[model samples]
Target: MNELFDSVADGLVDKSYAIIDNFLTTDEVAQILTLPHFNQHEQLFKKAGIGKNADLQINEAIRGDYILWLDKNTAPPAAMVYLNRLNELIQHLNRSLFLSMKDYEVHMTVYPVGTYYKRHLDQFKKDDHRKLSVICYLNTNWKEEEGGQLRIYTDHDSFDVLPVAGRLVCFRSDVLEHEVLPATRQRLSLTGWILDQQIM
Candidate 1:
């Protein structure tokens, strides 16, 4: 309905690369989080302070669990906006790739400040459920030199994206192996995937 949201959707449909810049503004993000229809689901913000050891041990090919600190008391409006934009992006990508998004699962996740996930692929072993992955940056006043870039490894090339404000990175969930490096500052972002088919 707004210019920022419209722009992000259009941009994602146009680009199928690892990084997309200026995807969503902070102001636009706040709107989606506060909307009653979007906010009423009531299961989003729950969090647990689990240590990083278990997360790191997660196998790369095996489908991982929803491991994140979902700030139960906080409304990360930016995250919601990005996730909304991402769902649209997946649908567009599906159209291009001749896949239907409704046949799978989609989820929204967040990493705040020091939250870092080890290198992994979103697809599952013997499942092949995940097809596309998306990450949306929400930190404002972020520095490109702060070192919170996503490290994506491909057979032919490598890609890194600064956890800068209003950026969304999308790639094939199975092809791109990526990790969230440690940051010099607080890095906030939305991370998730669109599975190829529903396993549950």
Candidate 2:
């Protein structure tokens, strides 16, 4: 985990993003995916929407996916374990880079076959607290031909990141505009943001 922290901090400083594969092992990914909470509370998931507060609305044309926000206070055991691990990372990053990240918000995102999200930035105009975006994919047996790639746009060029199981993609929330390409197979991932404490 320390090694990952160093790598993440260095990557963020150098390029504002990092893509790491095998952050979680195959067996660990399978274990999380097989958790009963996903099956038992499937109905809790809802169609993903765009914007926030009054501006928030389901816009299928922009993003066709479903989401279940994970509650930090009431997450299931397996999920809690993962969150704790991430919290450690939050602390590590703060110590190393003083990012001012205080908490995190996460959700389970599912893109059904043929679904996709258009290019967009993660940070909204109303909120600057979202400092970093993190996506840990859990799609096993994914193939390039299946086409559910995460296309990240940079200043000079763009890159397509395959949604392979245990792959972790971290990036600046405000700087990069990205999109999810339509997939022939269903795609699953844990997506979230690292946030700074808002002054009240």
Candidate 3:
């Protein structure tokens, strides 16, 4: 809808960057097909042969709903609008707030019912490429008690970003430790890192 963002979005895509906010509306996200399959990816991790029912959460996730790899090229026009919005946000943070550009990558993550991700770091201490973390929640009709809050940890405090539709959360990917609490309702989000331009 705006000309200013076209260049900005292109810049961020070229350089690993950071910024966050409602990038995808609920209806916009539903365009991506989701199929149901049980522990289909277990064989991918068969080397471990995790015990039966021994909690196959992460191991089985690569199979849709549990975890879906978005075909960004197929995203709707709404996604383009959202990217422009993010470009604006990043400019605000950089010029007004003074956030440094670092190595990062952009991505989308979706979680369905009874799904949860354990606490993890955006980038490994040794591998510092993922410097900025951004998340945009796209699940409509979400409730606090539904329990899919993004637990973010800072030096002295921890905060939860409830998975509200159109809500976005951005933070230091390297310094922030976060997790997704299990949800009673289906929860969805787009999460990714922004890398540094100079690094490329």
Candidate 4:
């Protein structure tokens, strides 16, 4: 696990983003999928919105996904496992990069078929506390043809990442402009931000 953490840190230093495959084991991914929030997403999830607080708004044209925020205190054992791992990563990043990240906020997101989020940066205009953006895909047997790829735009180019189970994508929240592509099938994932300020 330290080796993996080192690789991610190195990627951030060299490039600003990293893509790691099989970050979670098959069993671990299956366990997360069994969580009540994921199984009952339709009932428990709320529509995702853009901006923060008073500026928050739900416009399907901008983004069309449902989200259920995860609370470690009440999370199931399987979910706790993932959260604990993230805590470890946070510590490693703080020590290695001096990011001063205080905590992470994550949610289970489900995008229905043919829904997408337009290109945008993860950091909000009024808030720059989000330093890192992380996503771990949970779609089993996902194919390129399925279409829900994350397109990240860089200074001179861009690239697409397929939403495959156990695949992890991490990038600088304030620096990257990215978007989700519409898919033929539902897309599921754990998505979040590593923040410099504590989230209350």
Clash pairs detected, candidate 1: 45-72, 129-196
Which candidate model has the greater TM-score, 2 or 4?
4
Count of residue pairs whose backbone atoms collide, per candidate:
2, 0, 7, 0
In model 2, where is the ten-residue run with the lowest total lDDT? 35-44
Predictions: Cα RMSD each: 7.1, 1.8, 8.2, 0.9
Model 2 alpha-carbon drift over 4 Å, by segment: 37-42, 198-200
For 27-110, candidate 1 gives per-residue lDDT tens digits of 764454344423322354434232233443444233222334333235366444555556566566565556676533333444
- lDDT-wise, the better of 1 and 2 is 2
* Residue-by-residue lDDT tens digits, candidate 3, 1-200: 23333433443445333233345555654542232211243322122111224443435342233333333355445554555555565565465436565333443455557767667676755556565677777677777888988887666777787877666666666676777788887666656555655433
lDDT of 2 by residue, 1-200 (tens): 78887888888889999887777779878888887645543476888999997999998999998888888789877677667877887898899997789889989888888999999999989988999999989899999999999999999999999999988888999999999999998889889999897323
- Global lDDT of each candidate: 0.56, 0.87, 0.55, 0.92
Candidate 1: segments with Cα more than 4 A from true spot: 1-16, 30-80, 103-115, 198-200
Give the lowest summed-lDDT range of ten residues in model 4.
33-42
Off by over 4 Å in 3: 1-74, 98-104, 198-200
User: Which 10 consecutive positions of candidate 1 have the poorest summed lDDT?
Assistant: 63-72
The best candidate by lDDT is 4
Candidates 2 and 4 compared by lDDT, better number:
4
TM-score: the better of candidates 3 and 4 = 4
